[model samples]
Target: MSAWIAAAGQALLIALLAPIVTGVTRAVRARLEGRAGGRIAQPWRDIRKLLRKPPTSPEGAGVFFSAAPVVLMSTSLLIAATVPFVSTAGIAGSADLIVVVGLLLLGTVALALAGLDTGTAFGGMGSSREMTIAALVEPTLLLAVFALSTRVGTTNLGVIVAAGASDPAAVFTPASLLAFAALAIATLAETARIPVDNPSTHLELTMVHEAMILEYSGRDLALVEWASAMRLAILLGLLANLFAPWGVATGTTWTAVVIAAAVLTVKMCGLATLLAAAEVYAAKLRLFRVPELLAGSFAMALLAVLTSYILA
Candidate 1:
């Protein structure tokens, strides 16, 4: 019963925190660019306004278009609930790496299908680009995490984090450091951040994610945007906890859980701020060159796996 409550609380917390995460990144980026940015609560305001409007589907849009938002939002929520964001004592015990990766991929595919359903030239183009990137990204994400899992002999996320927490020394090895770099790059690409796809860009030529949602409005847009924010937050939280699970509660104690929750929030916001600062110094890569960036990350992941074997 305690575990169930913890899981539910984490999910609800993440859902609420998602917009703030996005807003933080945007605000940081804007400030870095010498512009006064919107408030940290701006994303929340945008989502609320969007929610109050009615969505209009493209003339030929069908079930896929209508279903994609729900599917993406559902998978994001499930991942948020299952991953050990705050308390490792709860649902984190069952958080498998493969399952989390699969859920992430499902959301990606559902959005791609929705993009195709629109039948617009840019929609299909964006879907193609997204799938191409996903092909390169998915492998790197799996292999990078696998590098960390090798030490513990299991791909269970909770076990991996718990093991690292119990033995902090193991988290700083050559394999672990290499895996962290690989996963960080994968996260940037996976979240459609700088040097991958710009969330703020609407230019049809450079848009990958934005193009897919060009046809959506109102409630549908709110869900998609909200889910995207949640995903970014979740990945950052996972990255922070996987390598630095120091504050995560290992027992179902309210005090420990509360402390862990506070730690998780700080980590997520810190990561988002750092990412935004990095983006200020970076530019989006040309479409053709994006694959090269992803390929390099994949190579890093491969090396991490090799290093793990050699060291182990």
Candidate 2:
């Protein structure tokens, strides 16, 4: 019961702090660009303002349009609940890496469908681009998971974390390093960061994810935006905790949990800063160049898998 309570608390924390992570990234980017940024809690204010108003749907849109935000937000919450954050103590089932990947893909598909249901040209184009990226990226994501799972002989994230904890040096290996690189690239692409799709861009021709959600307004927009931020935080948390499983609690020790939380915050901040730096220094890729990015990620993931097999 206590474990379940802890899990629930962590889930809520993830939902709430997700926006802060997004804000931090934005602030870092602003600073890098030599401009003063909004407060770290700016996203919270935006969300609050959004929730106070009713959504306005396009005149011709139907029920699917109304259901889209609910689906998007719900899927993100489900994913957050399933993922092992502070501890694996009370999660309903084993946190399998494949299952995690599948949940994420499911959420992406839901968003894409929502985009298509709107019947807007930009929404359709966004959905098409999103699907194309997903199709190209999934193989790499799976391959990277396969490499790590094969090394630990389990697809369960908790088990993999435990194995790595027992042998910390294992993370320094070439295979793990390569897999991290591949996952990092996939994370950026999946999260719609710069050099992939600029999160802040409103340009119709260049916008991918933003284009799809352009029609969403008020609370619907808030839900979608919050969900995206949560997804980003969850992905970065997984990358940090899974690859570098240091300072994470294994049991219900309060002191250990506190330390773990601190470490988690620090790691997430570093990742957010790094992402901001990348976005600041890089330009968004041409639409046609996206496949090349995915292909490189796929190759690196494949190499990681091969290296793991050879090392074994």
Candidate 3:
């Protein structure tokens, strides 16, 4: 019961904090570009306004169109629940890292299907680009996961973090460092961030994710947007907790839990700043060049795995 409560609280905390992270990243990017951006509270306001409006389905849209956003949001929540934020323990019993990756893919697949269902040129184009990117991303993501899992001798996320927490230096090896780099790149691609797919772009030819949901409006759009934010937060949290799980609480004591939460928040903010800085200085790659980026990430993952074997 205690575990259940902790898991619920942590999941809720993530959902609530996700928007703030998105807002901060946006504000930071704007500031770097010499513009006075909207306040950090802007995302919350946008979501609330969106929620008050009615959702409109695209012409010829089927039930899948309506269901896709819900599935995406649910999968994001599931991913959040599986990750260890405040504690190494999670609510789900089979919350393996592979399962987490699979869920992330599932959400992407659903969104792609929804895009195709809309039968618009932009939607089809986005779906094609998205699937192409996904094809290159999943293998790299899996390889990175295998690198870490092989080192820890377990696929369960909680166990991996707990093990890393036990021996923090073990995560500083060549394999670990390489895996982190690979996963970090994969995260940028997976989240539709700049240099892969710019989140702020509306150019139909360049948009990957935005084109898919271009027809969605009102509450559905809000949910999709919120879910996107949560997914980003969860992925960065996973990267942080997996590679730097030193401060994560392994016990159920209140003081430990509080300290764990505080550390997690700091890590997230630091990562957000890094991402914003990277985005500010980076230009979005041409659609064709994205495959090369993913290929490089895959090579990194391959090296990380090889290093893990040689060092082990």
Considering every candidate listed, which one attains the maximal TM-score?
1
lDDT of 2 by residue, 1-312 (tens): 366666666778789889999999999999999999998899999999999989998877877778878877887787677566666555722477777788778878878887888899998999999999999877887887677877877788777776677786653367887889888889998899989999998989898999788889999999999999998998898888778877767775667666766787788878998999989889999999999998998999999998988887
Clashing pairs in 2: none
TM-score of 2: 0.96
**Candidate 1: RMSD over Cα atoms?**
1.0
Q: Using Cα atoms with residue i matched to residue i, what is each candidate's TM-score against the true structure?
A: 0.98, 0.96, 0.97
lDDT of each: 0.90, 0.83, 0.87
Residues 62-111 of candidate 3: C-alpha lDDT, one tens digit per residue: 97789989999999987776577778764632378778889899999999
Q: Write the per-residue lDDT of candidate 1 for residues 192-214, one digit (tens) a residue.
A: 98899998988989999898889
lDDT of 2: 0.83
The 10-residue segment of model 1 with minimum total lDDT is: 168-177
Models ranked on lDDT: 1, 3, 2
How many clashing pairs per prediction, in order?
0, 0, 0
Residue 104, model 2, lDDT: 78
